[model samples]
Target chain A: MTNEKNKKVVIVDYAMGNIFSVKLACQKVGICAIVSNDKKEISNASALILPGVGAFADAMATLEKLDLVRTIKEFIASGRPFLGICLGMQLLMSESEEFGLHKGLDIIKGRVVKFPAVNDKVPQVGWNQITKPSYSNINWEETLLKGLSEKDFMYFVHSFYVLPNNNNIVVSETNYAGLNYCSSLREKNIYACQFHPEKSGESGLLIYRNFYNLINK
Target chain B: MKNIRIIPRLDIKGPNLVKGIHLEGLRVLGSPEDFAEHYYNAGADELIYMDVVASLYGRNGLMDIIEKTAKKIFIPLTVGGGLRTLEDIKNVLRAGADKVSLNTIAIKNPNIILEASRRFGSSTIVVSIEAIKQNDGKYMAFIENARESTGVEVFSWAKKVEELGAGEILLTSVNNEGTGSGYDIELTRKVSELVSIPVIANGGAGELEDVVNVIKQGKADAVSLASMVHYDYVKKSMVNGSLLKNQAEGNIDFLKFGKISEKIETSGIEEIKFYLKDKGINCRK
Candidate 1:
């Protein structure tokens, strides 16, 4: 029964970003994920990886083409766990300027914007610290962030960041250039991160293990 | 300002650090644990450990090896070689590696980039490509010890890697490695420009000047070298010495501050003109 509960995870692939790593990540935890763009598959799967990468407008356009917006809203409404990665996390925003006007899932009210910087280094590269997590008792320390050191350094390579409308959704943060950088967030069943825990080594791997445990719950 | 990394590469077979005298080569240097501590003490930015041929042997990572490396080294470490599926990546990550890289598998199945990125996180996945310039003037991405070619163009493939959720691109130039000629400048810049993520240059590097030149002229974010650091004729300490000696005279005292201040203070960077006056190192910018 526990194995059955862990069996189904759908990697929503609308051709917007890479959904393979997420699927593989799940597979590592003994779960075989179904990569799908179909509404029925997404809604039916026990868990989902709403993975996205590339320009926000393009991601929105693809989701619209697949008629995914409604299905995602419908699926999330079902209270199943959904995980979004970098751009995956960004697409949950209400709007973005990655090309032109675009709308996101709005599950967490917010907008995604290109990183504010004085230089043309739009994409902040390499590793940095992820420090501030909004909720202290959300099992984050015991789960996703388990093996990581407090203020554990994780890998980051992005030019845009999200501003969640409801501050309560934020789980943790990092900093770059003396500016407060938001790195991770959690709102109910939806969890996200702007940094790569998978690449973060042991601390990062522990985070994945925790996520697996989360969806199983 | 993001920190410009100073890192070292350590190749571990079972327990000791191995240095290759030539390509596909091998020779035990010393305890990897010892070298890792030495590099950390020397102010290296991060560390990378390549299993070399562990996967081909049907061997899993040595837990003792990982524990030793993780316990002694305080910096980030990316482990690569023979990573075929998400499970493989996960096992490595679970053992406490900072990032997992895919090379040969990614060429055969480009989707591996996305799968790993999703399961772990985008920033946790790195696409380590072994590229060689072809007679036709196109750079080709190879896999399985360069036995197979993806038939995909390097620049196009770089874009695909990013699109698929790869956190960064680790590019090694086969033509330039061991020669100390220099990195493939045009190829490095072109790929870096095409991808949104940081591009690391590898293969050819002889001295400290080569590292600076790779970044300045090649427009790369960072460069990686092995023989350059592990050889008898050359060493990491020698390179740093040369880098320090190459600096302009007068602000000689500035060299003493690197340990306490990993980076120059923002205020000092602001009053650059005055600071330069102190060092007397002339700069147009």
Candidate 2:
């Protein structure tokens, strides 16, 4: 609103946490981001960020209470830009098993689950590489992975993920147990990732930058 | 292609990072936020915060710390320790932590991992396994070291973790803890072969050579080290040298773990090292 040339990208902070980083990340890309739990602020914004950092079910409850689920869906449907991070990303799915049968935004026909514990250790902590050459094209289209390469590394810290019922939603993938699992996902106007672009350093910032650019129009 | 991961681990207690020898009597080392920012700048792909005092506190106080660090550090931060149930995982995730890691509880109820993954998807759940080579020379599961034996083969249980919907494995070797003898290559190798998910090798990493050796022998996707990397004890030059040697020999490829660009050269490694150090991160050296 202040700078006509600057795009307005509102970070939908429903007390879901990670509001600050998501906001800062967007700012790094020169996007004028306003962190708000307000529906009006969200509705007026050219772009929306549903930043989430908690359980899938609880996050959904919060979104529902804020009457954001419908608004978010409307934005996506209207071809406006939207991005979901971590738990926010998980909520875009149909449902998650976090607290027993919790429903999701259902924009993408998928489910979220906790990371399985192999005999080794649970919570595959720390940095690991993500790869699957075939997914390079669709994934690159995702603003979150912009300015990165096919083998580019993004930071991850999740116990659950979005399982696209439709593989076309899978933009990029990273292997964990020799199996290629969807990492970043895209569907028309909406985008999401199981990994955190906020914490992925420069590459992560680029993702925010690209997502921000989507709203410039 | 095997993805290569370099992770830095931080054991947090009350917003501060405390690294102890063998997960006991943690000493106040530095700020978790600063350390995380440092590592993120140091080319560390992801960082883990193990709540070493979850048992004493009766809960995982990861949210406050997670939100604090996530604000300053833009990379992924994982929280583990003292998780009682799936609800606990939700609480931490709500608190701004990226993922929830469960260990002791997973041993008590493996279905928790299965249930969470079945509903939420598998990539979010991480199961940490504490393995000890028993007197019989066979690996057995432990919660906080060999305190309570699960009487299960480490590698066998690793397979179970994957089946239960775990996204990745955090493998720590009790025999290697505090010893600085390098990683438990055999344990890493065995688990790597057992599960197809990414495996993170923790517990013992004395130097840059140890880091390279662990990934090479174990075929692990990532190497997670705490004190060695966090305290600046491991020299950045060594890490650069090691990575260069590995790359030159074709021992590893850049894209295995996801590189923004594979522009790193044996010679360029030094330049990147300086970039990281200038950013105030604690590296392997």
Q: TM-score each candidate.
A: 0.56, 0.65
The true-versus-predicted C-alpha distance at residue A195 of model 1, in Å, is: 8.1
Give per-residue CA lDDT, model 2, range A100-187, as digits (tens): 8888888889888765554433344434445544734454654456567766766665657778888876777776533467777778
Worst 10 residues of 2 chain B by lDDT: B259-268
Q: Residue B204, candidate 2: how far off, in angstroms?
A: 1.5
lDDT for A74 in candidate 2 is 78
lDDT comparing candidate 2 with the true structure? 0.69
Which predicted model would earn the best DockQ?
Answer: 2
Each candidate structure's count of clashing pairs: 21, 66
Q: Score the docking of each candidate (DockQ).
A: 0.10, 0.22
Alpha-carbon runs more than 4 Å astray in model 1? A1-123, A127-217, B61-63, B147-150, B232-285
Off by over 4 Å in 2: A1-45, A49-79, A83-152, A155-196, A213-217, B58-62, B233-285
CAPRI class assigned to model 2: incorrect
| Complex DockQ, candidate 2 | 0.22
